[model samples]
Target: MPSGRPSGRVPTAEEGKKPGARSIPPGLAPRPRAVPDYVVKYPAIRSPRQREGYKGVFQDQLAEYTELLGEVRTAQRRLRETEAAMGRLPRHATSRTRVSRGRDSAFLEKQQRCEYLKKKLTHIKARIQEYDRDARDSAVYF
Candidate 1:
């Protein structure tokens, strides 16, 4: 009788080697580095026309940013005016003295304007980010 239990097959020479003798483990191998498909297929200068278009779009975005900055400045001025008007109200000891409706309305209006301006600024900032993304994407080439 055989000393070892009989199996259907015997191990191959490579599999019979010591663990350290194997160049790579059964489950592990160096992965092949991947190259971007676009870079592999196309030259860097393939789209000059598209690059020009992106530059034009970027310039337009710069102009829009300037306009938004101006609007922000105007909003700041309006806010300052409202604050100054609020400051002018008398701080008197008379309990019976009522604040004027006109002043209160003005103050509310100014607050609303400031809020609107802040929202507008946020919108403009989002637009700027979109423009930047577009510019970046357009600049990328194979």
Candidate 2:
């Protein structure tokens, strides 16, 4: 046989026991800190551009430069392939020969395109240099 009884009871102050009170010491206990009026009155200051320093124009236009350089390389490769094909044509294939004429035209067109790509690349490099010079001479952020 067994007896049933309530196992829980409220602790009393006489026993130097508090069931729910925080155990932190009085001096070290957390308290609300009152901030100064000036600190609370002013709004936070922030810059528009996170990266304000003058990291040259080259960095800013890096993607464009890379894309143009890739175009130039592709044009050069195409020009080389066209030249090689023209060279492989038989010596007997003269100006009157359709195959010879076609190869010659292709070679000329590819050469012109390669030249244009080279000029465009030079223009892009000049623009980047100008930007760099401007960045060096002037303060971008106020």
lDDT of each: 0.55, 0.52
**Pairs with backbone N, CA or C atoms under 3 Å apart (clashes), candidate 2:** none
| Per-residue alpha-carbon lDDT of candidate 2 for residues 69-88, written as tens digits (9 for 90 to 100) | 56656766875776677778
After aligning candidate 1 to the native by TM-score, how far in Å is the CA of 12 from where it should be?
56
Q: TM-scores for all candidates?
A: 0.31, 0.30
Q: Among all windows of ten consecutive residues in candidate 1, which has the lowest summed lDDT? A: 37-46
TM-score attained by model 1:
0.31
Candidate 1 ranges beyond 4 A from true positions = 1-46, 91-142
lDDT of 1 by residue, 1-142 (tens): 2868777688898779888785676668878887643333322323447445545554655666566656656766776775566667665633223534234565556555555445444444454556667668878577
Off by over 4 Å in 2: 1-53, 92-142
lDDT of 1 at 24: 72
Q: Choose the strongest candidate by lDDT.
A: 1
